[model samples]
Target: MSPPKSAQRLENKWDASRAKNMSEPEKLLYRSNLLGSDKRITNYGGGNTSAKVLQKDPLTGETVEVLWVKGSGGDVGSIAMDGFSTLYMDKLNALRGLYRGVEYEDEMVAYLPHCTFNLNPRAASIDTPLHAYVPARHVDHMHPDAIIAIAAARDSKALTQQIFGDTIGWLPWKKPGYELGLWLSDFCARNPDARGVVLESHGLFTWADDARDCYDLTLDIIQTAMDWFAEQTAGKDAFGGARHQSLPADQRRAAASRLMPAIRGMVSGQQHMVGHFTDSDAVLEFVNANEMERLAALGTSCPDHFLRTKIRPLVVDFDPAKPDIDATLAGLADAISDYREDYMAYYERCKHDDSPALRDPNAVVYLVPGVGMITFAKDKATARISGEFYVNAINVMRGADAVSEYRGLPEQEAFDIEYWLLEEAKLQRMPAPKSMAGRVALVTGGAGGIGSATAERYLREGACVMLADIDETALAETAENLSARYSADVVRTVTMNVTDEAAVVSACSNIAAEFGGVDILVSNAGIASSAPVEETTLDLWNRNMAILSTGYFLVSREAFKLFRVQDMGGAIVFVASKNGLAASPNASAYCTAKASEIHLARCLALEGAPMGVRVNVVNPDAVLKGSKIWQGEWLDQRAGTYGTDKDGLEAMYRDRSLLKRSVLPDDIAEAAYFLASDLSAKSTGNIINVDAGNVQAFTR
Candidate 1:
């Protein structure tokens, strides 16, 4: 359909000058990216695009028509040239001769590798046949929200006809594979001049001989749907009008922070799960609607929507007006159990003889009336993306429900797609998760050397790290560097003074909101001073005690609070010093604070044991290379006391150790990681010294 002139029209982004110099494949990539740039057009990793272009055959030196389609599991928004799979058109067509029927469509996937063009390593997705069999030179299969609102409407076929006047066709929902590709081919052959077709309860498909025309048609078709809906539902109250008022933004997040941890504990039994919360305007509109619960129970129609969000969302029994958080927490177990039981029942009702073993059965999405949505997955990105997908579903429901009744896929069909054998194979083919895959850590004094090293190590192991430090500049720098190496998703930064009790509690809540809950706490924040018994002032003593001993106590206490809320076992690593055990001249205040830190760790270890929260210590001596404590008065004072200059003090500490080695920040970080990791899971109330065999600091 040619979209009408309306204010809701999509921006036409075609740049003639830029495209004038591009190859055919590059133009295809450009079109795909432009279409995918807007979530309203298509969602992340939800759709596929393809082009048929003539290329010189690498093996035969002959001109050939190659099918370049988006590879399996690649997102069009971020895809590059290498993301497309190239296959010979003739080989793809020949597979039509091999198609036994719709019953045997999955068998055709194994033959795709045989048809590779130029030996491209990118595997062709199942949608390859959908693109290959179509007669057009370019094809775009998108799940635009505006068009899907029409596609998922109760009378989808009639709506497609009314909007496009037979210019764009319609096909009932069929699982994508060999048969559906053939269905599209038959439709195009019959409706010769049609611009595209709407797949009922699915998405939109547009095609043209030219890539630019295809892009234009795609934008126009989706815009027409948007404009048409805009006119049809001009004055209507969406979702039968909002049934409840939205909570204030602060209150909304406060509720999510309270709920995510408890829910994570219940759902993370098989594998730990990370969480994401959204209170966006659209999410608020949907969750606060009168029809929200009914529409949610119907589930999502689009395969990609339900695949990411699960069959249906669980409507959390929370009332914003009552503000009963304790009641919500108390009932969460029963709510989640009911959801799991319902999912398992669906599985039993829909299982085929060879269906894959029942999967996690937990709902990926949770909807809280007057609050918003919460989603959980094995990692942060997935959890975030799942929330985004649900928002897309929300948009679809609003549009469809306004003009026509919203319709979800039948339970049997949703089950088939969710449990498709091919999908199970894809799931099995994914690489094993990293060891610290689903854990989150908070590193105090994270701007310093040992702290940054520990954060990086945890990030490398697939854990999310929230860096908390008193120094804002250093904290930002450390977070930026680590984020550059290990994506921004897994690393966050907060300016925190560990000795501040309120700051400690707030940081704990922020981490809960950012990555769901906390599992590891590395209390590495510290300060050092040097003075004889007579010269040690009360202020100096108090400063050292406050930062080293009391700071550790504050962060650990807050972490234990989160631990109780989550019911997940926790690991706490306190970075102390060798001075805690060995008496050194002219450092009474420093040694006393370090000794207090060690004894505090022992007491916490005894208290945390019954709750499965482990507490341990890493003590280091003279970690001078990148140690922030070594940069000030302590270095000069220690040098003067030992008859050495500033440059020679590090060497003195090295020589003082029995093994004669200098301990760097990374070395201390390694010991902290070991104690915080499962390597020392069986041991607590213990100290691992990274001080190169200091005899006097040895444990008894």
Candidate 2:
């Protein structure tokens, strides 16, 4: 069947004036962005692009041809001109003559430096030579799902010929290296009419004299394959509908919360690990299918996915019909133990004498029939990426099965790629990770000024954050904004009232299950109350004590228990106030409650010291901006007390501080972050004043 006219959705958005003004490499960056912006073509950092350009040699001042390939680990969607590694085209091609097929992976690394055009070097991608040998002015490479679905099928060769005719050539599976590059060059030269080549169990490549042509050729081939796929699977329902479960969403969340901690304890070995849960409609539908175990055991649709999804996902058996949380957790714990044992055996079976040190022997992604999909990795971003890839893999596998039987790369082939030197080098070349990379943090009152600021700070440092607040609407909005910047799995929200002990326990349990366990606890939930001691109403005083005092105790108690169970050192930062340390007229209720909470942390620090827990305090004053605590009567009261309008209160407080700097929410958040991180590892029971400078509030 021919591709439909409407199947091609890509339109050339390149502005001629835009290209005319930019340099050759910048134009290539613009083109690469166009290609990567669509996830159907490539995801995250899975693809590469390059162009051949003329540049002057520094020594001879003569124009020379150079191949500018996308550097290793550079994401095409956000790459800059500097992201391209410049190599001497003539010198790089000379390696084709000296290639021996053996030890190609190792030799490729040793030879990369010599082939580059300059002394200041960047690591070129493993596919660099494949682009250099294409004999075109520009080239684009992508791992389009539609293309990989067809190529990874058992009858890939026959499918290629039938769908694309002679316009596309097919290459058999060979590990990417100098040998593969030479083979591609020879095959394309022999078939002059071939506009692209389909690499079996790999990806697709296209080349043309113009950058836009090469990019469009990629989209054209992908559309053709997708059109054929649509026809092949027209009415077949290979994946069935979901099964009705005994538990509802709320119950399932509760059960998952109870089970995740035990499972993480069983599998994390010595290092702390983070976990994420994803139950999107696509995932639940796939997991609930009758043949889910059989379908999932099949290898990934592409080898590149192995780096993220691993060779296969572990299927966890969960019968929602019998929803006993304790029994379910015990069962999951046993299964995780078995999975870890099997992973180690597999690693030992496939390892070579010179193989790199073995990573943690645990599955990165797990398939739970009732609870959706869960991904476990060293950090939040990697875990989220792993889940994303597995979600894509499920769709590709279904597509391949719909057309022909899904066949993936052999197990041995996957092992080779996982341990390849070039792949390892790519990981090593990544920039230093953030401080809280693998940690999980929880913030009380996360919808307010200080809580929101603290949550954002922890997220910026790469920690998985859970925002708990009584204001469900505000919490949802804050979560949406943060999710846009990072990912949904990285920033989550729970509608929790801190004063409710049962609700606090349940919310903390869910957080433990969702992210293994919490490492940092920021107890920042409190309400403001100011009245003369004699005139203070019982309701006003009790409200302050409920949220400010009892709330702190309940949340900290839950966190302390989890920390003790994990036997890992943890940090707790209490957002007290300078008002607690300094006496002010008509502020008895708030001052008393905060002072008690501050002392409670000191007691916890002493008790937790023997167990390696550190507890500290950040006392802030006059952070009026974005503070929900100062709304309604509290704002007017403070304004009247300061003899100014509401807007003037902030400036008046700033003037009173010795340093003349107004205390801000972020200022308090920075102090909290330092206490939560290793920067304050040696200090505990210490209060960091973020009031700019308050001599009266100083503690000796």
Candidate 3:
């Protein structure tokens, strides 16, 4: 069996002249993209590829053959030349002779630095030696789900022989290291015609003179394994039991939002961690399958998954149809504690004196009886990665269970890989991650100047943001621009009128359901009204208060309720105005409403203190460039008050402040971001004035 011709995306497109023109690194990178783009082959950060290149050392001007392997933490799907770590092949190959019976910790990891060809060496993948020993032009290693299905089966050796006969060589469970690579090289030496080898309970490897041949060989072998698996399970239940369906989408979402917070509260230690909810039809079906508890507890599909998700996932039993969600959530804390205690016992059972200190005991949690899975981690990327790997595990395990019993590596082997020094070094190689990596921040009126800028700043700090505004077009455009700039799906848009209590409640629920819970709220939406007290009509006053005062109350009230539910402290910043502190003639309505919103923040701050929630205010004046409030009649009225045209009013407003500078939205956003971040952790119920020293608005 082979992949359909159309499935071959790595077909040779290069003629002799084109191949001559392309650099070796470019050719290798092109093949990496072709192989890594398909999830059937690899998941995020799970696979490595390498090319043996002959290049002249820039410093020495000597041509050397170096093994350019994928660097640790580099995704093969978008790998660049810099993503590879160049190591001298002779030095890397020399280690194979000295690797006899030595602890990988003391020799392999410590000696890797001596093998590098470059002065500033990037950390290479742990499997670099595996490629170096092959002496092939190109090598590809991927944890394709199809191969894992067969490799992790109960009788994996027999299945390996049955599937590919003599073409595939099989190695029993061994933690990846210099020894494993040596054994693989010796096995291939014995079988000179072997297409590849199946590292039992791990992954697959294929090699050829051409990169395309190597990639295609991987695909062909995997397709053959998949066809063999399909034939073995013909007319049988793929899931191995009766399938169940989940609750309706709306009910399922409601249940996730209501229950995820309790899990977050119990699992998050001193630091706050966010949960991400994800489920597909396949995931739901797997969750609903009979005996899922036993199947999911069997361990990960492969060892690399252990680095992201632990060896086993924590499964919680619950019924989404039950109306008593609060009762369900109450019992979850005890269950989570039980899971932690069990994890510690496992750690103690497998401890070596040299093992790294125990990692955070919490593992990704899986829910059943209606809702799907919830992944918990220090940040959003890790959480999503954990969830994704587990989802892949479900499919692979099902495929294995369909033919024979599914089996992962024994607990001891898994422990060895999890605490391996080479694996642990990968984390050390990564740069320090962002501070707000996993948080959720929502900005009201996010289409406006200050709100949009604040959202952008949060995104830069690694927080996923939700932009809420009544203007759907502007909100969508802002989200698009931010997404393009960041090259991430970190921002979402919601059309919301903050004054409507129902809309506010629904929006908050949606945000919680999407990203676990809200970590920060910027209550920045408002309208500006300018009129003399005698000319201020009932309609004008009502409209002004509705947006400025009532809107703030509604949004803040909902956020407060959610924060209490999550039992996690959050930050709230209200964007007030300088006019709130100092009275201005002919703008009684605007000034009064602004003052009301500021006091509203104070009142909420006092209430939220005991729970660790912080509330603050940012007062900015005369941000004319992007301020929607400064256009139309409001701008005309303010210019008239200063006895100047609109264009000259900026200077007049600047002259009124002590610093003699015009305020901008970015200035106010910086103040709000500071208050919402940990910088102002202890300071709440405080106002940050961004008006360039307005004496009238000065506070002692």
**How accurate locally, in lDDT, is each candidate?**
0.90, 0.82, 0.81
Off by over 4 Å in 3: 1-20, 57-63, 104-106, 118-120, 321-323, 487-489
- TM-score list, all predictions: 0.97, 0.86, 0.94
How much lDDT does candidate 2 score?
Answer: 0.82
Please give, for residues 274-339, the per-residue lDDT of candidate 2 as tens digits: 887787766776777765677777768676687887888888777766656566555776677787
Ranking by TM-score: 1, 3, 2
Q: How close is candidate 3 to the true structure, as a TM-score?
A: 0.94
The candidate maximizing TM-score is: 1
**Which residue pairs show collisions in model 2?**
none
lDDT (tens digit, per residue) of candidate 1 on 394-471: 888988887789999999999999999999999998999987899999999899988999898889888999999989
All-Cα superposition RMSD per candidate = 2.3, 4.2, 2.8
lDDT of 1: 0.90
In angstroms, give how far residue 593 of model 2 lies from its true place: 1.8
